[model samples]
Target chain A: MGRFVIRRLLQAIPVLLGTTFLIFAIVYALPGDPIQALAGERRVDPILAATLREQFHLNDPLIVRYGYYLRDIVSGNFGTTFRGLPVSTIFEGKFAVTLKLATTALLFEAVIGIGLGLWAALRRGRWEDKAILAFTLLLVSIPTLVSGFVLQLVLGVQLKTSLGIAFFPVAGVQDGIRSYLLPGFVLATVSIAYLTRLTRTSLMETLRADYVRTAVAKGMPRSRVLGRHALRNSLIPLVTYLGADLGALMGGAVITETIFNLPGIGQQLFTSVYLRENPVVVGIVTVLVLIYIVANLVVDLLYAVLDPRIRYE
Target chain B: MKNPSIDTHPPADEVAQEPLLVVDNLHVEFATRQGVVRAVNGVSYTVNAGESLAVLGESGSGKSVTAQAIMGILDMPPARIPKGEVRFRGTDVLQLSEQARGQIRGQRIAMIFQDALSALNPVFTVGWQIGEMFRVHRGMSRRDANNKAVELMDRVRIPAARQRVNDYPHQFSGGMRQRIMIAMAIALDPEVLIADEPTTALDVTVQAQIMDLLAELQRESNMGLILITHDLGVVADVADKIAVMYAGRIVEHALVHDIYKNPAHPYSKGLLDSIPRVDMKGQELYAIKGLPPNLLNMPPGCAFHPRCPYGRPNCVTDVPPLYEISGTRGSACHYYREVLDGTVQ
Candidate 1:
């Protein structure tokens, strides 16, 4: 397992390098010049502009500039923004909030998604299953941004309007568990639908498996047969979906972060894209890609735990 | 060595003296979109302790369904037992509540299935599955249950069972996986074991080995063994008595030797003749001429009449009652006298 982890981590090095290079190239090719944009429509000497370009390595060929960016990033130097603030510093504060939001949302997805899915499968072809199936379809059909706004309007504004209470957690609490709930739930909506669907389908198939019948023939209590035999077997596909979702969710947090007004990498990257901030964008993108790789590695290792038949060399 | 203390409840042994299982006129029908499909119709048989009863027939002949009904594992709505009584000793299992029947299942009359690869849960170790039988029924702790699982695996003659106890079902070969399944079924030392085509998925050599293992285990426990299969050759030696089914009814029932020597029903004779003999090398292998009747659209009279060599106009018009050939046998063909008296051959 240790060797596997090392190998996976080693593999991520090249992916990280490639992602940084490609993203840096894309950001470099953007129409706006960062130094001139930083000059902000105000008059400046050509010498000052030249000096700024040289300082940032912008005057060099794109390849040379990318080489420097890669080296600086490798050495843990994300380089300073044009405003003179370190990109690392900006990301550090924001990464924590996004992590909290993403993790909370993931927790919500796991609990509600798996629970509803299992319940729906147990009650398959019944009213409960139909209701959940319809509810999840509606959830999936609605666009994420729209759902976010609608949730904000209802849970944030109308809950206070109708209930006469501070229903929005963010109102009083800041960066706490309660504060994360509204945004986290909003973020979890699409994933919950996906997870519920995944869980239900996998569980339905697993429930019908011959092994489940064997367990039943073993005279196992109906609950244990479903819980231990069926549920565990079904969890394999669900776990795969979950890990991939989480990996993707690390970067996919942009809209959710923006909607909730959370200062995370997603929001930071979003705001920086408009300003054409290369270093900050590449840094955040690189971190999220690395995070995604790590999440997949965890998922791979978890497979051995979930299923004994899947042994790593 | 690990008996699992079946004597934990006294009288379970005394209860076995009457008969391990008795299925009386079991009628299992599946309600489908088109109509009610008759799966097991008026099937009756008895299995005694320390005896093996092989319910033999071609596919869709209701042998497995009858076994499922007796085990109370048949899915309802799709499958309904309109009229039946599965008597375990004296009590009718069909009349019992689901919970009461569950206690009787793995604890009293366990079952093994064909295709061990699919039957054993892929995620769990063989020991864990075997241990589960103990853990759930006896409320054994994880450590004790695991130890018990290893013991069961070892008893089933799995080589180096201690090391292999943690191995998943996929790690084992076909025959070894079947052994693991048998181990799980016998974990509780149940009074009866219904093996539904248990050797069908195995090769000839592995099939023989599995049958041998089953016979050995049955001897050790004196358990009533219901070996369900379509292959006459596979069960000839293992089964003390054979019940040949046509469609959903038992067309013939007799001691294995008597049935093999003088099959009372034409269907039974046809089945026995289809067994390819080494002495008859290069001779055309005989196969029963017609297809088994579809339950949804069964023929009006004897389901096997269309395929029977001795079939006549009367046979096509009538469903023959099982004729009493002797004290120990019955045949369901109208022309049983010629078939039994060696005049037909």
Candidate 2:
């Protein structure tokens, strides 16, 4: 098992490297002068700008600059912003916020999504099943960005602009629950839709499996048969989806964070790209890729626990 | 082979004892988009403790469905048993509450299905599955159930059972997995066991091994075993009585020896003739000429007349009721006497 995890980690090296190259390419190609952008409105002399370029190694080849960034990344030094603030220090606070949002959203999605799927599967072909399925399809059909805005307009809008009361706080991280609720709910709905569809199909197929029939024939109670025998088997695919989705969600649903004005890493990454903070952009991308790989490894281990036939070796 | 000496019962006393399971005029129908499928029609049979009743039929002949009905495992909505009574020791099971039925379904009467590889849960260890039988019905502690699971595996003749108990369904051979299913079914010493084509998915050698294992288990427990199969060869040696099903009803019910010597139904005759015999050598093996009747749109009267060699004109107009051939046997044919007397070929 240890060897399996190590091998998986080794294989992820190239994926991380490729992502770094892509992030580096984007930051390297931005059109503005780094010194001029840093100076903002100041009328800096062309000679001073030239001298600053040399000091920053701007005259060197892209490869040389990328090599320096890579060395810093390997050594756990995430370079700095144009203002010289360390990338790691800036990321630390946002990381916790993003992590909390993703975790809470994941919990909400899994509970609601998997619960609906099991209910629909059990009451298959009934009106309630049809309604849940239609609702899931509707949720899946609407893009998260559109839904996010619509939610902000209704629940987040203080109706006094037209009617009178705000049901949920519209934007920004505030104290306690108000901080993540609206944005988290929007993020969770999309994942909940996907999870619902995946879980429903998986569970329906599993319920028809011969083992489920055997379980029933064994005279196991309906609860145990569905819970222990049916749902446990169905979770293999659902868990795999969850693992992949976690890293992606944690990296950020850009539209949700941007619309809600959350200072998450994804929103930061989006802002830093336009600002030409190359190191911060590359730093966030590298971290996300590593997170994705780790999540997949954890999912693989979970598979072994859920199914005895699967061996890590 | 390792079963203790079976307690012998005198024939008169065996006859007087109440049957463990009695399916009387049972009707099972499946409602589909196309139409209502008459899966089991007026199917009636009885199994007594220590006896083996083999229900024989081809695919689509409702043998397995009947077994499922008896086990109380048939899915509703599609399946509806509108008429008939499944009497357990004189108590009608249809009238029993769900919990009461469950009390008998797996505790007093358990089932072993075909396709054992699929029947055993792949996600769970074979021991866990067997242990589940104990855990759910008897309410045994996990450790005690686990220990009992190992003991049951050892009883089923699984090699290295202590080590193999942790192995999942996919890890075992088909025969071994069937053994695990049998072990789970018989864990609580059920008085009746219905094995639905238990050996169908296994190779010939494995089939024999499973049969031997089942026979040993049955002998030791004296359980009423309902062996449902299409293969005549598998059951002829083990079954005491046999019921040959045509379409959805029992066409011939007789002692195994009597049925083998003088089959009272043409479908039974045809089935027996189709078995390839080594003694027959190079001659083309006989096969029943046509398919069984479609359930959704069955033939006008008798369901088997299309392929029955001795089918008379009346067979197309009227369904023949089961005719008493002797005190212990009956045949659902207009001219069972003629067939038994070897007058109809």
Candidate 3:
């Protein structure tokens, strides 16, 4: 097992390197100079612009700039943003907010989704199963942005007056738990639908397995048959989806955050790109890529733990 | 190969006075997408306490289905017992409510499945799974259950029961897993134990050991043993009576010695002839001509008529009822005498 984990960790190195390098190249290759964007609309002397370019290493060759970036990255420096803020400082504050929101959303999705899935599977061919299936399908098909706007209008605008002052704060993450409730729920609904369907299908398949039948014949109660035997075995496929979904959710939260006006890494990335702040954009992309790699690694390790048959190698 | 000393004890007839389990006119069918497939058609048999009854048939011959029906574990919507009475201690099992049936299932009647590797849950320790029977049914405490589990493991001859009790099913060898299954089945001292092809997945040597274990356990407990398998050789030493099932019907039912020495039904004759005996050298061992009949579209008369070597014109038009040929021995064949006397050959 130790050997297998070591092999997997070794394999992850090249993947992480490739991802980081690709994002670095793409951010640099995009049109519009960071130096020009930083200089802004106000008039500045050409001599001063040249001095600024040299200071920021913008006049250096692409490879030389890349080497300097790599050196700074190795020394735990992500360079300074075009706004002259340290990349780490910008990311630390924004990342904490995004992490809190995303983590809460994911936890909510997993619990509600998996619980709904088990309920649907157990009550198969009944009205409750049909209702859950139809509702989840509806939730899945509706666009996340549209859903967020709709929820914001209903729960934030009209419901506040009609339904005894709406419980959740419509925008931002400042109003404690209530402020996060709307956007978090909106972000989670789509993922919850997807996960619930996946879990339901996987659980249904597991319940029909010969081993489940054997367990039942052993005089195991219906609850134990479903919980201990079927659910544990069914988690293999669900875990796989969870890892990939976590990566996608971190990357995909851009639109939802924009719609709800939540101050998260996704929103910060959007602002950085639009403002042509090269360092912040590049740093956020690199972090997102790193998150993907780490999430996959965690998933691979978890797979080995959940299923005895799986070897990391 | 006569055992005169063993024979001196008593023949099966003398001991057939009290039946431990009696299954009468058992009809089982499955509602599939195509249609209702008659899996078990009017099958009947009896097993006395301390007797091992072997229901012999190839795959899909309704052997396992019969066993499952008897154990009350048949998945209902798909598998329905259209007609039957599985009476244990004069109580019709099928007539009981779901809760009542569950009460009797593991406590009174237990089943050991074919695939031992899959029979046990892969995630849980074998001991925990085994102990669950006691914990769930008997309401034993956790410590008591664990101790009982270790005792069971030791009884099955699993080495180092103390250490291995914590090991999952995947950690054990195939033979050892099968032993664990046997231990679970015998844990509660069930009155009737149904072993459905218990050794089918084991090696030849392991198969012998499992059979020996089953026999030893049965003798000690005096439980009615229902050994379901297609292997005629397996029943040679263990089964007191043998019932040959074909197309879901018991075509031949007799004492094990009688069936082996004087097989009456043409299907039974074919089955006995097919086994490659050490005494019968290179003169081509017989193979039954065709596959067992499809239950969905079974033949109008005897289901085995298409495959029976001694099939007659009447055999194609009429189903033969099980007729008593001698004391406590019966055959569903019109020409039983001819087959037994070698005239059919």
Candidate 4:
């Protein structure tokens, strides 16, 4: 297992390099000069402009600049923003908020998704099953952007005002965990729908499996058969989906963050892109790529735990 | 050696007149889109302690469904027991509440399936799956259940039971996996062990070994063994009696030797003749003509008439009842005497 983990981590190097390169190249290729955009509508002195360009390695070719960026990253320097703030320092608080939001969304997805799915699967073809299916379809149909704003207005503002209760904060994390609940659910809507369907299908198939019948034949009670045998087997695919979705939730929180006015990496990523803060953009993407790799590795390792047939070399 | 003093229930041996397990007039039907499939229709059989009954049939003949009904494992929405009584030692298990039936399930009557890889839970170790019988039913501690699992594994003749206890079902060979299934079934020392085509998925040599092991285990425990299979060859040595089914009904039933010698039912005669013999070296291998009847659209009369060599015009319009041939035999054929006397072409 140790050797397998080492092999997986080593494999992550190329993936990290590839993703970082792609983001860096895309940022470099964007139409507009960062230094001129920094000066914005001002006629700066040519000498000062030249100095700024040279200082930032903006005069160099894309490949050479990427090489320098890679060297800095290898030496533990994620570079500084045009505003001269270290990108890592800028990331500190924002990463935490994004992490919390993503965690919240994931918890919502796991609990509600698996719970509804198990319920639906057990009571398949009934009205409860049909209602859950229709609810999931509704969730899947609506985009996160619309759901985020509409929910913010209804639950965050309208409900709070009507009830004359400070139930939900309109925007930001001022209310700590409670502030994230609405936005977290909005962010989780589509995923929860997908996960519910996956869980339902998986559990249904698992329940019909020969092993479940064998469990029943073993005189195991209905609960044990479903809980121990069926549920455990079905959880394999759900775990994989959830693990991959964590990285996705973090990266895809841009719209959610903006709608809720949350001070997260997603908002930082948005502003950084508009301002042409190439260093900050690359740094954030690099971290996300690392997370994606690590999450996948953890998922693969978890497979061995969940299913003994999947032993790694 | 590790027999933890299991609570001594009333010995099934005391009830000599009442067979260990009796499946009487059990009718199972599946409600599908096309129509209700009559899977098991009026199938009645008795299994005595220490005796082996081989239920012989082609696929879809309802032998497995009958077993599932007796086990109370059939899914209700698709499958329904319209009328039946599965009596275990005198008590009708089918009439009992689900909880009562659950107690009787692995504790009193256990079952092994054909495909061992699919039957054994893939996520759990063989020991855990086997030990589950004791853990859930007997309320044994994990350690005690595990030790009992190892003991059962050893009893089933799995090599290096201690070493392989933690291995998954996929790690074992076909025969070895079936042994694990058998081990789990017998872990509770059930009074009746129903093996539903247990050797169907095994290699020829391995099949013999599994049958021998099952026979040995049954003898030691004095358990009633219901060996359900399609192979006539697999039954000869182990089975004391046979029940031949065709289209969800028992067409013939007799002492294993008696039926093999002179099959009264034409369908039974056809099955016995289909068995390849070295003495008839150059002769064409005989096969029962046509397919088994579809459960949803069964023929009006005898379901086997389409495939029977002795099928007559009357056979197409009339369903023959199981005629008592003698003291220990019954044949569901109108022309049983002609078939038994070798007077029919």
Using TM-score, give the best candidate's number: 4
Best by DockQ: 4
What's the CA error at residue A276 for candidate 2, in Å?
4.2
Worst 10 residues of 2 chain B by lDDT: B1-10
Q: After superposition, how far is residue B16 of candidate 3 from its true place, in Å?
A: 11
Candidate 2, residues A1-313, lDDT tens digits: the string is 5766677678878877877887787777878877777778898899988887776678999889888888888998988776779989989878777877787788878899999988888889999889999999898888879889998987778453567665567788775566687788788887898898888899999999999999888888988998899989999999999999899798756888888888888888888777777667878887887788788888988887887677623
Clashes of each: 0, 2, 0, 0
Write the candidate numbers in order of decreasing lDDT: 4, 1, 2, 3
**TM-score of the candidate numbered 2?**
0.90
lDDT of 2 by residue, B123-188 (tens): 888888999888888889999999999999999999999998888888889888999999999999
DockQ of each: 0.74, 0.75, 0.58, 0.85
Q: Global lDDT of each model?
A: 0.86, 0.85, 0.85, 0.91
For candidate 1, what's the TM-score of chain A, rounded to 2 decimals? 0.92
Worst 10 residues of 1 chain B by lDDT: B1-10
Q: Write the per-residue lDDT of candidate 3 for residues B60-80, one digit (tens) a residue.
A: 889899989988888887788
Writing each residue's lDDT as its tens digit, candidate 3 over A105-203 gives: 788789989999988988888998999999999999999888999999999888887876867777777787777777777888888998888888999
lDDT of 2 at B33: 97
Better of 3 and 4 by lDDT: 4
Displacement of the residue B328 alpha carbon in candidate 1, Å? 2.1
**Off by more than 4 A, model 2:** A22-68, A81-85, A159-167, B1-17
TM-score of chain A for the candidates in order shown: 0.92, 0.87, 0.91, 0.95
lDDT of 4: 0.91
